[model samples]
Every structure is written in C-alpha cells, then in structure tokens.
Target: MSVLVRRAALTVVAVAATVLVAITPAQAEPEGGTKPLRDALRAASQGYQDARTAIANAKKREGELSEEILASQARVADLSAAVGRLAAAQYRGGSSAQLQALLSSGSPESFLDTAATVRYLSERDGAQVTALKAAQATLARQRKDLDAAILEQENQLKELRKRQDEALKALRSAGGGDPTLGFGDLPANATPAPRNPDGSFPSEGCSVKDPTTSGCLSPRTLHAYNETKKANFDHYVSCYRSAEDGGEHPRGKACDWSSAAKGFGGMAVGAEKDYGNKLAAWYIANADRLGVLYVIWFRQIWMPGTGWRSYFGSGDPSSEHTNHVHLSMR
Candidate 1:
C-alpha cells in the first residue's frame, strides 16, 4: 500500500453573596422591559441550536467511521484468506514436490524448473503475508477511529441535553413562554401570594429607589434585595450590570446578594451555607407575594413548580451559585 491512511487516536462558577435570583416566566416580561431578556433568550436558544448541529455532525461522523470500520474488517478478512490460500498451495506443492515433478516433468531439468516455480510461489506467499499484516494494521486503526467517533457522538449528545436544558430554562425565565407551544409569556391563574396592606413584602421594611427603569431594578427584585437590607444582616448587595447578567442584571430586573466572605470564586460553607439556605427559604416562602421568578444559592436552584434540585454547570463556585444568591424579577 502506497499510502497508509492512519487513524489518529482521538482523545477527548461559584455563587456568593445574598443572591436572590429570579426566574421569569416564558411569555412574561420584566416590568423593566424585554430588550435585554430577549437578547439573552436569543442567545440561549441559539446555544440549543448549535448543540443540535454538533450532535448531528457527530452522529454523521460516527456513521462514516462505522462504515469505514466494516470495510477495513472485510479487507482484513479477504487479505487473510488470500494469504491462507497462498500458504495452503505452497504447503501442498512442497508436500508433493519431488513426486509431482517426477510425474509431470520430461527430464531432470524439469525438476529444476519445478523447484524454481516452488521458490517463486514461496516468495509470493511471503509477500501476501506482508500485505495481510498491513491490512490487519489498517483494520486496527479504523476500529480505533470508529470507537473514538462513537465516544464523540456520546459527548455531543450529552452536550445537546445540557444546552437544551439550559435553553428551556432560559426561555421560561425570559417569559418567552413555551417555544414548543408557540406561546409568549402566558399569564398564570394561581392567586398571588399576599403582600402587606401597603403592597409591600410582609415586613414592609425594605427600602428601594422609586424609579423602576433605566438603571433601577424591577419592582420584585428591588423588593427582594431591600428585604435583605431591611434585615440589617450587614451584608453587601448589588443589583445591576453584573458580569453574569443574562438579561436580568443589566436590565435592572435582577439582584445578586454577595453571600460569600470572598468574591465570585469563593465557595460558601459553614455559616455561609446556613445563610444561603435561610435566604433561599425566605425567597421561596415569599415567592408569590414578591413576584419572584426563582432563587439560586448553594449550588442549587429552585423555581415555582419544581422543588430544589442540583444545578450542574461549569462547576466553578460562581457557576454553582455558592458565593451569592441571585434573584430576578418577572
């Protein structure tokens, strides 16, 4: 073989702070506006599309590799059989060499000619054996490529699931409604949880700037953050233009309370963990009354219908939401 097609072995956020994150319903809009959320939703939706494309590509490659593997196996079997036939012929001829030559040869020179033929056959067999070995090597490489492609397909599927999960979550949070149902921000019929007489949270003690637009947070997020402030917890809080906006922060519809002693990458534990648990519970307890979307803290996320569940992501402290409680408004 002039060219041996070689198969290369294919080797394949902490959250801190008093974060009060919110999940916006699909088809609903933040009181602030929809521009930022729309952009975020678009991005999330795009991610899902990309994942699907990647999975498709992976599967296609897997199929091609599988075909190539089959071809390689067939070639190897054929070459082995060819080599076997050559060896068998050589064995049979060598077994009857003298006797067969005497029966067919015209004279002693015929014996010499028969010996030469046998020698030529032996050389051909040796060459066939070499070719057979080469074919086997090629088969081994193709099988390796096939296995790698299979693994790649599996990874792509996993990625597709993750992206789809996140995209669905984002769509629901962005009030895009259910994309599958072609609805936008559908309204809920559930009676809202009550508020204080003054239309404030139960404590009615949190303070917020009046304007709800521009750089100001939406009403619900502001209320949640203010609740933290009103508690006199001596904690630090920020509501707008966070690095991880995804629409809520920059649009001023989200608030993240830094729950960690350190920032961003800090892992919350011990007292920090307790604080996050209590805060998350508080938000869940007040969700309906405050128009809260969702709450994320301590490596977990909780929304209205679903209870607490493990939130998997980049696995960093910030990604885990262990450093803060992120709260957003609808």
Candidate 2:
C-alpha cells in the first residue's frame, strides 16, 4: 500500500481501538442486552430535570435580587431628597440661620442646644446616606451574580438535552423501539399492541363511570386486569392508577399487581415468588393475543423474542419489579 493509504488505515485502526477501550463489556453487550442503554437514557433524563430545576431556582433568585435593587434605589433616592433639602436650606441662610435661633433662645442652655442640633442632624443624615449608598452597590453586585447564574443554568440545560437525545438514540438502537425484545423469535402472526378506539389509550373502560383511576383503563389492558382480579392470586391486583402523570400508566395501558401493601420490596421467598412467576408466565403466554408489549415481575423482564432477563432497576423493588407484576401493552 502507498504511504498515504497506510497512514489513513493506521488512523482508523487507532480510532477503533480507542472506542473498544472506552466501551466496557457490559456496555458492548449491555445488561440484558439493552439495560445499559436504558440506564444511560435514564441518567440523561434526570440530568435534564435537574438542569431545569436549577434554571428555575436561578430565575427566582434573580427576581429577588432585582426587587432588592429596586428597594435600595428607593432608599437612596429618599435619603438624597432629605439631605438635599437640608443642604439647600443651609446654603441659602448660611450661619445667619443658626444666629437667628441663638438670639431667640431665652437662656444660655437653649442657645447651645440650637447650635448642637444643627451639627447632630447634619452628621446623622450624612452617615445614613453613606450606608444607603453602600447597600445599593451591594444589591447591584448581587443582581449581576444572579444574572450570570441564570445564564449558566440555561447553557447547562441545553447541553443536558443534547446528551439526553443521544442517550435516547442509543436506547432506541438497542431496543429497536420495541418493548418486546427478549422472548425468542417472533411469531409470523405477531402484531402490535392494541390501541384505543381513538388510537391511543385513554380514560375509558369497564365502566369509565368510576371517578378514581381504579376504574379507568384501556379496553385491552382491562381484559388482562379483569382476569388477574379473578386469579385469586395471593397479591392484590390493581389497575388504572391515577397518581402517575406520564408513561403507560396514566395512558391506561399499564397495570401493577403488587404484593407489597405499603411500599415496594422483595416478596417472601415462597408463595409470593411463585405467584409473581405465574403471573409473568401467564402474560407471556397470552402476549400475542392480548397485545402485551412486556411483563416485569420477580426481578426479571420478559419481552417477545427476548425471553426472560435479569432486571437492574435503581436498587428499588418497585423499579426492579421484584414485588409486583407490571404489565404494559402497545
């Protein structure tokens, strides 16, 4: 090969080696083949939220500083007006004003008091004006600092969003935009999850008449939900949670049947584990017909073609699905 071509090939090899070194085995293969990418996306999302909060706080502080600056300016103005009037009167009448008061005094003590009052008033006004001036300067500096902080926060948010988008792209590549990735080869008849009559899952099901979310659910999700209710399972089966603001839950396409009554935690090793497993298996078995996208239970995740894989959530049973059977649809 020519010298130029050899150099070009060497550069490419160097870049490839750098990438291989930077990406760990877990990242290359990913935990459960996709968890690493999902983890990256989650970190990025949290960073975005943090950056937004910082920006909001900075703005609030900036507003407070502005108010302080305004109040200080008013103080300085009032001080100036009072001092200015006193100065003008002194300049107009000069020492004669004090002499006139001194002559009107009926006694030596009264005359001395008139002269002392002039000196005391002038000194007090001067000291107050000086302090107000310093305070105004301090307020201005504080406002400037807040402005810089707000700008910095804005820049950080922009950068975080860029990273968030990159993480999402990597996650999409790892999961192929499909929640059902692990249960093995797709059936020739496999199809997308069922959508609502209006296309996206929404509030309406069983009787849409119930006010609390416990009554609302997507029609297809409700089918599985109603079935679980009858399974006489050891755990409570719940659907249509109203607390969540986003994702499949609020949309009525997800449900959580948890054994933990108060909080999410590991289930007792015997029947609870068995119940969770059965619930998971049932969903996987009926996935095709029921439009199931994925099932999470017993600290594992199952998706079409991907089979069962150990789940690594944020060290929480709720997140790991260890104490609950979390089901989601298309």
Top lDDT model? 2
| Model 2, residue pairs in steric clash | 181-306, 182-305, 182-306, 182-307, 183-304, 183-305, 183-306, 183-307, 184-305
> Native-vs-model 2 lDDT?
0.58
Which residue runs does candidate 2 get wrong by more than 4 Å?
1-32, 93-96, 99-106, 175-330
Clashes per model (N, Cα, C within 3 A): 53, 9
Model 2, TM vs. native? 0.43
When summed lDDT is taken over every stretch of 10 residues in candidate 1, the lowest stretch is 24-33
Query: How do the predictions measure up, each by TM-score?
Result: 0.38, 0.43
lDDT of 1 by residue, 110-221 (tens): 8778878767766877887898898888878877777886787688667756655664565456443332211112223223544544343342212345332235555555
Give the total clashing residue pairs for model 1.
Answer: 53
| Candidate 2 lDDT over residue span 1-330, tens digit each | 999999999999998776554322111111122445544544554355445545666667778777877887787787778768767877898458777877899989987898798678667767867876786687678777867977877796786667556544544555433333332332222233454443332334444422224456666676666555555543544455544434455556666765543323454356666666666766777675566655666456654433565555455456556667777664
